[model samples]
Target: MMITQVRRPATQLARLASLPSAASRPTLNTPWRRFASGKSKSNVSSHWFRNSFGFALAGTATYLGYTYMNGDWEAWIERQKEVKKEVIDVNDLRADFIQEKRSLKSPGVYTWGSNAHKVVAPESKDSDVKIPRRFKYFNGQVLRDFKIDEKSGAAITENGDLVQWGKGYSETEYKPTKTLIGKNLTSLALSESRIVALSSNGTIYSLPISKHDQGNGPKLRESSWMPFWGRQSTLSYRVLRPSLKLGESVTLIRGGLEHVVLLTSSGRVFTAAASTEHYPSLGQLGVPGLSFITRPSGPVDTCHEVTSLKGSKITQIASGDYHSLALSNDGRLFAWGDNSFGQLGVEFLPEHPFNDTPSALPLKKLYRLSIYSPKVTSIAAGGANTFFTVDSKRILGPEEDTTKVRDLGRITADTWSCGRGVWGTLGAGKWIHLQDSPIKVKDLSGLGEYDEKTKQMLPIRLRTMSVGTTHVAALLNNKTNLSAKNTDALDKSSDWGYEAFWWGGNENFQLGTGKRANLARPAYIKAPSESSKTPEPEARLQIMPRHKGKVGKRNVSMEQRVECGRHVSAIYSAV
Candidate 1:
């Protein structure tokens, strides 16, 4: 088509592109660069596109250098200072929990640690208690089975009256409000929003916290209906007549955040939903059907028996906030529910983080408790940890007598523990969580039994032990090993052998060892100061009144009680 001597546009463009590569095009001025057909990029330093890229690269380097000058994130920086918790030998913690450990004769109640919400009496002082001080309100009252937590407290007085206190429990922030929960209730347990009590005649009762927890709260609700769940709130403690076989009656009861564990006199184990509509089933119920996937639609009033341990005669039972343990008469230990911190005493598996079925702890294979089959006589669960007292060698000395006067206190067990190891709560050392096997709590163990050959009492025997979320408290019965000459010169002061030894987490000064630092092993805690009014500003150390009582002298020591809650510790030493 050269009729008019004009070439097609494509042909003309191709001919131009074929011209000498570098001498053909001209440069344009704009925000961006545009290259012509045969031109080579020469003065790109002045080009807008190249200049913008250079500016971006330089700015990136400058920002990186600025970032390097400053510290990393606050959390990261703090994390660097934290060394993984190792086995710290707390030489002070395991001195002993005492026997005959009841101050009922004088009824002294001591409270220490986090006082937030005034869970303990002296409500005016809002500061955390750094030392164990006698509880203010109960001067003349005789409270038994006294249990408390961050929110509330419940106890059965000597008169068989049920009382509740705290802004979280009965809305009585400053005083102990008497709540006639149920007639003849012997013992009770407290949770954040629920309270459970057991009657001597094998009945169960429950009380829900009205002010703190909305009754039948949303999460615990069943069905989508708004009114049904809302009306589920209960004010008075009502008897939970959980269906039992003809002769089955609950002999023991313990409470958790959302459930209550029941051990029947018949050696059967059962669990019922203690809280409704607010908590999810985390296998704490120990019932296969009650789980996150098949949560109950409403209040699970039925007592679902622990099926996995069906045939065994479960003698002792314990519960943490989310886990449960059952001890059989044969000294076999079974655990279920939450194992997030290895509280179940079994190795945690990623595929199975929590367990609903009861499983045995590998005592011989893993822990090697004395190279023999573990004789797990007693077990305790709290927070995310477990405590076990193995009667490895049966020490038979005392005769069983039901009379209170004949009560000689409990045996100091060979302590073993596993699970969340923070603050040395496991009593093995400040260790990583979920120890592969239960470790011998040297501080709490190694003593408590009468040496068969020596026929002599150990220095101290763990009489009473309280396992809390982050700490443990023991009332050690101080044994007298002095000669007859030393006995005559005994100092009969108000504070004899230190009444208590505390170990583990002190975040809220719960350990009451005076210093907030936790004791990985056993450490000595001073008896409360005798000074009143203006309490001494500093902690004082008293070397145990140089051994006085004769080696076999009848220990006329005043009995004391040791108890601890989430962040509170108590030593009832009214004597």
Candidate 2:
């Protein structure tokens, strides 16, 4: 496949002189004498004048006759480009990652709220879900890990398969269907029209909700000359090429309204836009010069690293519709993108409101607790608001194990909110315009119980909070018995029962509290009344397994796990 470069005839003259040939020997002696005469009335060297014209003619003739100069070289160059464009699936996932635990089957899920289609429903035609009711459409979390937005949703199932559903998928199937069966996907990120999946081996794949939204065809097979018989399988996904440029594989993936944020194995944060064909991106992609004015030209399938966060090791990421939040290992949080709604949790100038640069929020100044300084433990984000849980609770021995709090969505420290106020998202119980700074949620702050039996306040905690687009729900944890000491025997988040409380908008009864009036302060969401209950469909009713404890095992059950999406709310529990 080698194509030699063509050389001009003048280069042959240099080799001709080194060959000890008589005709090619230097003859400068006669040319210098002619120049010294000055009779030619010209500044040009007589030696060059006599030899240059002939050399130019000879070089042109020689180059035109060269074999590679015809068309083979151009074809060879194109072949090399095709080779560079083709990517091989290396399956290069890093080995040193946290191991995932196996989840039990037939986990029960309760859902309420509405989207454009109102797919999440209670029994019968009741529009309002003022009470927590089991969602029978998808049969609970058949998919272990899932994420949903205002328009679409994606999930990674227990068997490492991918499932998708929502409005963006209207051109395709609108219901939850098994889209990818054998990818062994570990995580899912859904944007407007695309679903980015992260495999167990760290490879990333982008799948389109509709066939027309696909960026490019699937990667070429191993042999460049392989033929297609059109008999194998449907080309539904494309391999993303960020790792080819970043030189690192991705470990995590999260979705925003129109942008997706992923963390690499090296702790680097990267962001990419949804399919530009179906959605327009603001500065949400986090790239400086790639906004509306300079929208992506070709397919929007590459991940651009956040260079603004170069030196910091970002451990976690969360995002709203147009803003993004990155949490560092040292409890430092950085905010960027659209701030007009104050979703970035920081102040901006009047003239210039939105910022694309990553800026750190002053966690140390805004929030601090006594005894143990508030170090951020975890972060959660909604359409226009964010939730930060900071715990100073330190444990010394195995009795102090609390790592499951995050997996269970339980918070041990005070949580705060800052964003738009149209839907009472700030939990301030009033209709304000916006909040650009951290404000303590009254129901979630300064929470310490008083045990009259001990004549003192008990500090045992199991509180968990879920924030939706307009409302908020929490499991107060105030009802749990105080053990005063962490013990292996005192387990089961449900045994330590939770009091359900909610606040904010009630247009769709998304707050799960019966009645239409909005709740400014936290109120207990009632269980479904016997009179309001409809007959259970034979196809949907089943007897859940009894909750039992294994002698040496932990995590008996998550009976009331809270979840919130855009105008949607749900509480999931184990079977």
Q: What's the number of clashes in each of the models?
A: 19, 0
The CA lDDT of each predicted structure is 0.64, 0.60
Summarize candidate 2's per-residue lDDT along 1-575 as a digit string, tens digits. Answer: 23233363444854453343677565768557756776473645564575676666665555545545566567656888888655433442111100000113334456666655533542345545565565555443444466554555556666788766655555345566677767688777666567788888887777776544442445333222346633333545766656434556787777776778888777888887756454434466676766655755655566677888889988888877777888889887788877776777787467767777788887666544322455665676666777676664433334444564332322246667787777676775666577888777666665776677778654433255556667776665564444422222222322233556677888876776556677766666544322345422112111121233221243343233566777677655432
Q: Which ten residues in a row are the worst by lDDT in model 2?
A: 94-103
Worst 10 residues of 1 by lDDT: 95-104
Residue-wise C-alpha lDDT for candidate 1, range 1-575, written one tens digit per residue? 23223224433444444444665454455214444343345655456476466555655454444444554345444665664323233532222212111131233577888877677654656668787666666654444567878776666765566776766754544367666533577777766567778877877777675544433333221233555554332344456766688988888887777778888888988887777444536688777756644754655555677888877899989988888999999889998888788888787887877888888887666343332334776788788888887755423235533454332333344778888886788877665756747778887675654655578554344555678888887655454333322233233323334345668899888877768887787676655653577333233222222222221233322334566788887654311
User: How much does each candidate deviate from the true structure in C-alpha RMSD?
Assistant: 25.8, 33.4
TM-score of 2: 0.63
State how far residue 515 of model 2 sits from its true place (Å).
2.6
